[model samples]
Target chain A: MGTQLDPEYVRTLRSDFAVAHKLLSDRCLYESAKWSAEALNGLPEDEVDDPEILIPDELKQLDQMSSSERRQYMLAKACFDCREYDRAARILEHCTSSKCCFLKWYARYISGEKKREEDSEVILGPLDGDATINKQVILIIDEIEEHFRTVAAAVYDPFLLYLYGVALIKHKCDKLAFEPLTRAVNIYPFNWAAWQELGRCVQNVDQLPFVLSQIPPTHVMSKMFEVSTSQELFQSTESVFATLAQLENIFPSFLYLKIQRAMLCYHALEYDDSAKLFDHVVREDPHRLDDMDMYSNVLYVTE
Target chain B: MGTQLDPEYVRTLRSDFAVAHKLLSDRCLYESAKWSAEALNGLPEDEVDDPEILIPDELKQLDQMSSSERRQYMLAKACFDCREYDRAARILEHCTSSKCCFLKWYARYISGEKKREEDSEVILGPLDGDATINKQVILIIDEIEEHFRTVAAAVYDPFLLYLYGVALIKHKCDKLAFEPLTRAVNIYPFNWAAWQELGRCVQNVDQLPFVLSQIPPTHVMSKMFEVSTSQELFQSTESVFATLAQLENIFPSFLYLKIQRAMLCYHALEYDDSAKLFDHVVREDPHRLDDMDMYSNVLYVTE
Candidate 1:
């Protein structure tokens, strides 16, 4: 009998078992979907006809426990799937065992959900399964604080730190965003997205010199100043001239910068300087003539 | 006379100039295409009967100038458009700054068709045209060098480097392909294509430890190996094992890895080890009992 139960017996049993598993799985899936739909529609739990369909007996057994216990079970599944472990942990408030507590914490840690106490043991533990979920949650929280903090704080996870810096800049937390963003960009030099976003972040500041100094001269002269004047009116006519002088030093042969400077001069009614810069740029890079013509139209209107 | 040359005169001149330029440009473009097609097809240049459709007279005239003068002119145009400069420079071989000298050097540089130089400035010149041609040429040259160079060399241009590295790996130049591919990965980490290629490059080496070491431990033990290995016998036994190890790591609790590994082990005739790994993986991840049954059949065959 132990000699593999005979081929025919095994085959029949296998087929029967597969059929049962499939039926159970299909039923479970259908019920899960129904429950999800009812929940999404905000129907009362009692109103759920065959709510049992949504929570299979196996899963419902966990739900029969306290909310915290149900959350613990859900958290384990969530961690397995690498889904919303932080939200699951937040719902699982009463987990007390060190392993369960750390599991909840590490889920937050790895997802960049939040920063907790920097205990070395907790940080270095096997960041797999529920532990990874806690880690992700902690990372997410760290990102939130790093981005929203009035002063920049160092982040342990470089990826999360990079994201945090970008979020800060996006939310107009300029002063808070600068240092971490700068560090992130410096750390990951080949990260083009970080460089582009950091350029945008710094460009938010009023002073042109600070922006010019930070970015590559080519990118600075081409991209930053195109939108800079439009976004920020020069504090004075001389402020515009000073910015132009700094730009000219940075990009000596950049025709577009010269044209932009010329436009600024023309806007200030400094026609001679405007005409000279425009003519010089047209001679050097004749492509600038199209831009110069457009600027001239704007000049005519402004006048 | 100055007053007579007013808006009407200027407009008329502009119209006449535009027409002439368009006609000339169209003619030039057609001739260029014809020449390019001939070159690509390996047709003898002397056999072409159409004299009018040969190189443009203006370009030919520029080619007749002194070498220094031609070089200066070519450099100016190269700064604007590298493809134009390459074509123009190719025709100016008779000049002191011979077309042969510049074309050979520029082609090598643009294609990363030579060994890497330490000076970033020397390597970082105008390669901003026809990236596909550049990649193809670099890949071909890289193959030729694979026979000669005992050590792998760094490929400078990121895109061409990646293509060259991928080709090197395809030809079984694992050691030669490693550096450029690793560099490409470092440059573009999120580039899934590069990552996949890098994985392939490492896998080409027969030793499991070497191959596994190149990838992240989690990846080596997880998903990459499972997805990459085929059921075909053409795939080396070592690769199958590496893939199994990676799958086992990725889905430690999934029975699929165990089944696949068992199949591989049976094929490799390492029946016992395969059975053990498969049994352990399946037992831990009981959700895959169906797969475990299939795996047991393979084990029965091996036994």
Candidate 2:
């Protein structure tokens, strides 16, 4: 155990790590889109990070509810929260609130994925996890794709827009993913998930400048997006480095910053310098496994 | 099957629903804290909504790695991401990056939870899940409390600070939690999760003013926090309504805004008006399960 610290001491450490994390991670995901498929493949099944729904205790009093209202919103929500997506969706079939609308379709979307999972297991047995081989998944994806496309158009909700883009991409309509994803980022630029989806729509380094032009250049997210895209596309190394340096002013001693720097050195083919940076990163964060593959390559090439 | 809609249609409807959702959900959670314990209890175990870590595909090529540098970051990360918390923590034992430090301790904290879960199963058989009954959990919480207290002092990382506050609260040192939570909200006001946590530490109506004073007054999140705490404490109904009205200018037709208004009506004994608003909500979102209990109450009281 260490010395007992005062609560007052920690109160002074005030910085928006949420925004910082979003800016960094969105860019990282953008950069990873071109270079890393595994990371993208391994995301949690539910993409929407919805805030936990809180019901008032006054409402949950068992004796208070009349028998007729048994088929109520909380019932459906309880099912949804318990991961009973189909049941939740069923209960929410006629509800009209935007939250209900979003949840209904979202629950359906998840149920579709769960269906696909079960189908894949049945079809592939030991090899069943692959969605490509599971023909049943295509039908589920197509249905969800349709559901999202319809609702996304009507609601224009950022989360729905982001999901629409993802659905289009999943349905192999990568070309169609660009518009909704772009709209999502423009409307809610703070959502790294939307930005990540939009970043995936870009085909090459040549497409990046046009994509960058579409986003708000002055916005920090746009700037972060540019940096991540440039890093992935292996272009504008100097500019990207400068932007990273600027970010460093805000996020000093940030682990990802060091990794980004090391990556920049690697891209420049300054293998010795890159190796030094990697060595430093290793020393600083021995538990970090995020960029070790690059570190290994640097060592291999130098050796 | 739905009609094939053009992506151009959704492209035309660009509004920042993320901001809308945040404002609404944060308020709902605040209201829930004071009235509903079960809703709070049902939250997912790991609370920080982190962006998925994306490693470049180029970095993951297996043939490239030489044997010596095999004990790298990727291995530890793989374990961590796979939920092998103890193994990941073991691998990252000496790592020095802030991310590594955070992960190492987070892994320990989770492992402690896992241990508690197992202990609960063993001691209680059927009754083991209740943390209060488990003496072993106290030790785990105390250890984590010590670790967070020490690191939170040095790092000043917002996530760490948030966790420190949470740990302190969990350790039943509620008074000590206030300062760190306040710092967390002031620094990264955008995180509803932080606001939710801070709101939890507030014990009464009198403490609300001082807590409000500590936060940036003009910030939207501060306003949201104020509305939430006010609603939970059932104080400042008129002012809270005014704030919600102002919020409505930005998030017009948002479900939660409607819910908040209806809730205000319910609080003010405007039961008839509240019932009508809820009726509208039901008509619009028949599938919605959130806040149905309250809706049920209005019906019961009216009947």
Candidate 3:
């Protein structure tokens, strides 16, 4: 009783499905996910507004992997995409020999979070290592460093070097920390975490000039090193003012810089300027108890 | 040598771990996960840009769920959060009598993507109505409808209603689809998927007046329905022209509206206007072969 409206309509419908299937089968997960979502919503031709799908389900057919490996790979990548590096590392650790070199390295690297924390504490925690703590941390650090030298030698990932540098720094080998940290930043100038560690690894006043040259003064973390290390090196206020002046130009609104300048003002006997800067810093960051202690010390002397 | 940096500071360190353990033991997965990550990274007070933890490793602690139920709950919730709704449903399907009612309803409702697709095809696919196709699709639809009516009767979740409306639409019970969809849009107007499907369900020529009153003409979706339903209602070009004029003001760059306008022009025997509009559409969406046949018909008339 009913006639077809267009002679080629059925062929056109089949043609549409051909295009849709091709889009879904594409190996690139992000691209395939986009088209598959559009087709699934019955809007085959239009780009759907896609803020809903946050993590791209990366469970596409991977080459030459067992079922467990594939699941771990997908889960690890999903975790990494979600910024759960530690969980990703955990999944990869459980995977029965990950074929992916990056996966193998990343799993070991990030799962070292607990070890890294303990190692840092032994080096920087209270300075009373008690012999046993240092021995335990050093043994673990040695194993990690040896693994990096052997297993990660073939691949040149900046993250691995970042970990290596962090381990060395926590081992109190600041001179050895310098090499990997330098290579890391040279490879990837924007690794904020690596740069933060690099800020703390400079050995003394002489090495500060070299590290400063390597790291441009414009970086906030670079400025952070000067403030943090001044106390570490017990540098005289007069000796550090030249460097602090350059940091001041770059970080005018920096709270730590204001406090650093206040400390310098206190040391230089500029009581009024020191009082004003300390008052400003406290108002800005009241919970910075270290700054409050410094403020009290300044007030006591100035009054 | 540094004399342990005060006995209290060492105890404070141990106390911090105690607090962390207490938090993790509290069965609040999100908060516990946060502290664990913070402790792991030595970033005690900072929000780390975490890129490796997924699913909060929620299987570790569930209040009273049996092991299988706990696993399924974690997998299902993770999948849902990741927008893998179909997968979530499958996991939830295997879950042994989940105590959480919300989880049960959602798993069953949304897991029906494949069934819904097949159901929609039986209703709207090729008007053949093969006996097996109708029986299977109707069976699934009946089950979904009955479940919604009884089990989800008291709940006012917009997503649950959205599922109900979607099932009705796929079954070609557009009149029944209207109630759930109307409530769906009422509860959440920005449900674009529901709003788009709602444009297709108005019954007949006579019902347009009532639906227009129910949904204001100023609403973009209501305007969209006018264009979509013009052919179905056998609306005269004159009747819809006023509505199209209003729609043009709202959606000036809408391709479907342009094609609808072109079709109306062709029916009205305004060959010149039809040709111009179809030509514009083809240029904008150069590969729209569906419009090509219409373009050919318009060209033949115009020439």
In terms of lDDT, the best-performing candidate is: 2
* Tens digits of per-residue lDDT for model 2, A1-303: 224433332221111222222222222222222112222211122223322223234222211322112223344444553456765676656655434544566667667767666666556467566543423335544644555556545445555566667667766778888887888777656556677777788879889878888887777567767766777676637778888766554345455666677777778888888888889878865755665888888999999
Can you tell me which runs of candidate 1 are displaced by over 4 Å? A1-141, A144-165, A171-238, A253-303, B1-303
lDDT of 3 by residue, B1-303 (tens): 112234343234323333333322222122223332222222122222222222223222223354334434543443444455554555455443313223544445544543445555446456334322323335445645655566544444444465566667766788888887777656544334555566677656777676666654465445656665774455746668877765554345545667778888887878899889988876754533434577788888788
Off by over 4 Å in 3: A1-303, B1-88, B94-155, B169-174, B190-200, B288-303
The TM-score obtained for chain B by all candidates, in the order given, is 0.28, 0.61, 0.52
- Kindly list the per-residue Cα lDDT of model 2 for residues B13-96, writing each as its tens digit: 111112222222212222222112122211222223322223234322211322211222333443543456666677656654
Give DockQ per model, in order.
0.01, 0.02, 0.01
* iRMS, model 2 (angstroms): 14.7
DockQ of the two-chain complex in candidate 2: 0.02
- Residue A136's C-alpha lDDT in candidate 1? 46
Tens-place lDDT per residue, model 1, B1-303, is: 112223443333223222322222222222222212211112111222221123334333323444234323333322313233333333332334322333433343443432222222343355322222233344454543442264334323333445556556645676787776666545433223454566565443354355445544443222344334343233436656665554443234334445566666666667787778777765553332334554666577657
- Candidate 2: where is the Cα deviation over 4 Å? A1-94, A107-155, A276-293, B1-109, B112-303
Top candidate on TM-score is 2
**Candidate 1 — what's its lDDT?**
0.41
